[model samples]
Target chain A: MATFAVDKTKNTIRLTAMPKVLQGLTVITVLGLIVTLYLGYFNAGTDIQQGEIQRIFYIHMPTFFGAFTAFGATVLGGMLYLAKRDDKWDRLAVAGVEVGLALALINLITGSIWARPIWNTWWTWDPRLTSAAIMALTYAAYLMLRSGIDNLQTRRRFASVYGILAFSTVILTLVIIRIRPDTIHPVVIGASPQNAQGSFEATRGVVLALLPSLLFYSTIVPITLMWYRIRLENMLDVLEQKKIALLSEG
Target chain B: MNTPFFSVVMAIIRKDLQAELRSRELVATMLLFALLSVLAFSFALELDRLAREEVVSGVLWVTVIFASLLGLNRSMSIERENDSIDAMLLTPIPRSAIFVGKLVGNYLFTATVGIALLPLMTILYNINMLNLWVIATLLLGTLGICITGTLLAAMTVQTRAREALLPIVMLPVVLPILLAAVKATTGIINNAPVSDWQTWPQVLLIVDIIYLVLCLLMFSYVIEE
Candidate 1:
């Protein structure tokens, strides 16, 4: 099996080839997504009130957890990077933001799609909605600010600190529904607020379909994508070092 | 010679305040920017008197936030101009004392601008903005802004786009403070029951504490060589 290695003296990173394990996991994750889609569309019964539009819930809700998991990795990667001063952890942090952002965007877009039919508006200034939007912007700022720094070491350090602090937005987005009484966003697990709209019970088939999708999205999808991203970053670092060396020689 | 921590903090604060007193640049710019922002908001919003009362609080917080952004960027850039930050790092006192000192100086300047805006807004909008609760909310919210702003300003001042990056990075982080402050101010202005708006101030306090602690812990990391 090919392996990933970093040479300290030469300042180079090498990945001979894709590992068989990651290849297998990617295939498994794709297959899992297909199975979950089948279970959601074909196996689960339609809702009495919301009708055909409700199946999007399978993707909508799970993608949020997917985002939560990815952002959580960012916090972890940030802390580890700061403590160890390792470039690999910095790469992990960057990967987390990219993957987390994609998942968060999916969550927001799906929620809007679901809300259009049910709530009769594509967007509202509700607490939950606003916080989710802020959460996405916080990480988007992370990427923009990260690229604006020139020194690699300072970039990594500042990115770590900012990454750790930015998690507050994610926490706020998660808890805003529970804390703010006026939010119309529904809670799936617990008793939703009195004014919550479009909340449905988690029946057996719904649970069966949702559980696998949630597991796959929150675990397999983010891990696989972040792994690939980290590999790409390592390769980029190697190219950067080679360019510098060529410049010095010339 | 090892300088004591509190003394180090006081010295930094004294230095910043003395510099401002000599030139009157930071606070003057912030106050003027804040005043212009209030005027611009009033004209742009173009609300009726009743609607103006509802929106005046949002305008107040937004102006304070942007003004503080200006002060924060200038404050750190001054440190960078002559490598004053490196000199401070060579001192014997703890690094966090430097953070605390800069934080207090920034907080004081921003809070001054926020407090001055109260009466100006009251006269302009015909809403009672000089209440004690509103002032308290302003102090708490600006404290939160300065805490994060000081840390981020230090980071952004070292970047290619120094001034432009501060708001883009800071606004989303401080959105909670803006939400709480605006809610509290609006409720107070509308003469709502104490119970109606009390939680907003409490939220402001909690967020302020959280940002203060986080900034104190991370400030050294940001400014370190």
Candidate 2:
């Protein structure tokens, strides 16, 4: 059961925050770094060919994997909202889009920086990049769709539906581009599907470092969503009361 | 047995078609807008005997998707502008039936334009676009678009920004089908063999099934509010 504490003297309401939320995020971030550093500096020795640029992999891959996890959350939140009619799920969907968008942007930038040293070109519409762009564009549109709808319930419902369906496009944009014979981007690097599919031979040491980062990123995403949801709920409450007061005065 | 369910389905379809026939204004506007879209693309790019196959596929699909938005907006608006959606809700018919009915209406309206475009595009581009595979992909792609579009249209119908918000909500989700359709379509136009598409056709089929089934199940809750 949820317990709420209200003080008459101060006119304040306090609720116990989920304590594990912060712990989990911190652990994940710390672990993510350890893994990244381990792969870059320690367990995996410098590659015979690409030295410093190879180090960026630690940052590039995890953020994207994390971004995919975040996009997947929108799909799940979308499904739950459709099933339950809960606004919590809707807020989670929006939060996932925002989180995923940030990470995807990072992933894209890191890849481009890495590409300049390796591919001799800063940009390639490789399957994965294409897919990422499409995914970001779709969710970005999801946000736009929500903004255009003034009615709260309708916005959530429509965006939830659109959110789930949009994820499907990521497949075509990313996967097809990867599979197409004409694509120029390397598979294992930032833009290729083959490399992403099974390219990195992650040592046991690398996995230990990376898994925590994944755990960390995933854990914080929901908390970020929950905080947003609460704020929205509070705004909604204030609006409703104002409406009722106006109705009574008239 | 194709019992009362099918009849109920037919009746719903008939009602929509009849209403559209009486008010031909909606389809006429959409068709006109679609043709003009084609005109713009033709003049802007000067699609001709020498135009590339990839451009042909891209132009045809783009026109279809935009025209779809037109049909979807007008069709769903019919319910929201009048008290028709509320009236339909009060009936004993299943919510899925209403969804299916709307899906069919949107499909027919959009597909009519799609069917016409293949020949029209062929004549303009000076290519034989009467390929069965391209036609099949178009049909599947349109089916996915309508299924997803109807649910979004229903939800958007109640919003303050009705027509304006439909494409914003739709294009991103509809992209995969569009991508696959465009690719397979180009391959067909370029005379690439069956060997070209090992799984593209399969992908389109899966997309259609997923969108239709998910929309069917979730549509009831969307309209409930």
Please write out the lDDT profile of model 1 over residues A1-250, one tens digit for every residue.
Answer: 5545568787566667788879998899889888989989999999889998899999998898888988999989989998899888999999999999999999999999999999999999999999999999999999988999989999999999999889989988988888788899989888999999999998898898899999989999999989988888877777777788899999
Per-residue accuracy of model 2 over A128-158 as CA lDDT, tens digit each: 5677777777778777778877877877877
Best by lDDT: 1
TM-scores, each model vs. reference: 0.95, 0.84
The lDDT of each candidate is 0.92, 0.74
What's the distance in Å from true for residue B132, model 2? Answer: 2.5
How close is each model in CA RMSD to the real structure? 2.1, 4.5
DockQ of each: 0.78, 0.59
Among the numbered candidates, top DockQ falls to 1
Candidate 1 ranges beyond 4 A from true positions:
A1-5, A8-15, B1-3
lDDT of 1 at B10: 93
Per residue, candidate 2 scores C-alpha lDDT tens digits across B1-225 of 366656667777898899889988657877788789888988898645546566988888888899999889888888878878888889877888889988898898888889888888788777789988888888988898898899988877777677887887788778777877888888888888788864677778998998888889878877874
